[model samples]
Target: MKILITGSTGQLSQALQTALAGEGKVLALGHKVMDLTKPMQIRQQVRLLRPDLIINAAAYTAVDPAQGDRDQAYAVNAIGPEVLAEEAAALGVPLIHYSTDYVFDGRKPEPYHEEDEPRPLSIYGASKLAGEQAIQAVGGQHLILRTSWVYSLHGRNFLLTMQRLLQERDTLSVVDDEVGAPTWAGTIAAVTADMVRKWRTGTGGPSGLYHLTATGETSWYGFACSIAQNLERQGLLRARLEPILSADYPTAAERPLNSRLNCARLQRDWGMVLPDWEAALHQCLGNANAHQANHSMQATQSL
Candidate 1:
């Protein structure tokens, strides 16, 4: 299988590259090489590469900035995805595109499911929701995987941000009210590889939307505390954590308070289940390269 993964520099894409290393001839494309905003360029690349599978990991993820930059957000998130779906359908290939939990308004008491009606609360969320709908409308062989609170050992994420702040500041405040699972990029990549393996064996399920996240849930403050606890064990942490509500610190983009998504359907359909958030975090931190990467990031931030 010739796998084409977009967003080469992103955390999840990088992890996917590693996970799918031996599975096929993987061609990961970065923004400079494959800009999602340009439909013509996307078509050109898809036609040229003629990949057997296209995994669209690219997205406009700047939640707050998206409020003022709606056009660019939609261009990349909505329009671009629609084009990709069309192209993938034209090629008669599967397009594994990643969506977000932000598609919901977070009003429901329970976890969001695939059948839940999305009511996005921000431009970024709305854009991503549009992309999901567009792809579905295209009626192509696509897996719209909605994930939440994605982090990794490398790249910019809550984990890396907390790691640096916890080391530098005497005190740090994180939102406690907004809750979701902190999913590791590594876990997502591995699960994706598993799905690809199943597909190769001709035992995959029907193409549709699905939720893929860590098993357990936690608030941003809770996630930070866990990061601290893990770092403290390694003598690399120092900070007094403070919990605050979402209202305490507002942003341009309204985020979903309840980011938790029920993964029972995914497991039932695909026989896939993720590890708990804490265990995944522990496993991610256990990587020796993580320490070096964290130090490098912190140093870069200081300079």
Candidate 2:
């Protein structure tokens, strides 16, 4: 089977590329190759590639900046997915897309379920929600996976930012009220590959939106502290982090305080569950370390 994955260089796309490589012929495309903002280009690419499955790993992820740039965000997030859904439905293929916990307003204290009505708090969230609804409206064979707090060893994420700043700065402050699971990109990709295999074997559940995230939750401050502890253990710690409230740090866009998502439905249907946030983080760092060691060994061999 030929699998086409968008956002070739993105964090999740990178993970998906590695995970799905063994399952089929993976064709990953970057913005230069297939810009999500162009509907004609998407349609043309899909027609040309004629992939067995289309996994849209692309997204407009700038949360705060999206407030002032709604048009661009919608072009990539809302309209792009809508066109992809239409094309996938036309081709009679499945399209696996990723959404976010930001679709909610963060008012509810409990975890957001798949059935919960989304009330987005920012332009980015609204655009994502729009994309989800558009795909659903198309009545296509689609699986919209809603994830939260996605981070990886690569990419611009909270994990990398905190890691660098925690060593460079003498002190730092992170929000304590906003809470969610810090999902690892590798975890998402591995789980997605499992689901794809189940689908191929005719054991997968129905196509619909599902919450796929790490089991546990934590605040930004807590997550930062975890990273700090890891660095300190490696003798790289330098920052004295402080916990601050959300109100203390105002941004152009509002964020959902309760970004937690419930994953029981996914587990019940697909028998898919991810490791806890801490364990996933450990695995990411371990992979990075292993990768670096291998590169060093290769260099020494060449020498």
Could you tell me every candidate's TM-score relative to the true structure?
0.95, 0.97
Q: Model 1: per-residue lDDT, tens digit, 1-303?
A: 899999999999999999999999999999898899989999999999999999998899999999999999999999999999999999999999899999999999899999999999999999999999999999978899999999997788999999999999998889999989999999999999999998889888779999999998999999999899887877978789999999999899889999999988879888897899999988898884477779999999999
On the 0 to 100 scale, the lDDT of residue 133 in model 2 is 95
In model 1, the clashing pairs are none
- Candidate 1 — which residues are off by over 4 angstroms? 289-303
For lDDT, the strongest prediction is 2
User: Candidate 1: what lDDT?
Assistant: 0.92
lDDT of each: 0.92, 0.95
- Please write out the lDDT profile of model 2 over residues 245-280, one tens digit for every residue: 999999999999999999999999999967999999
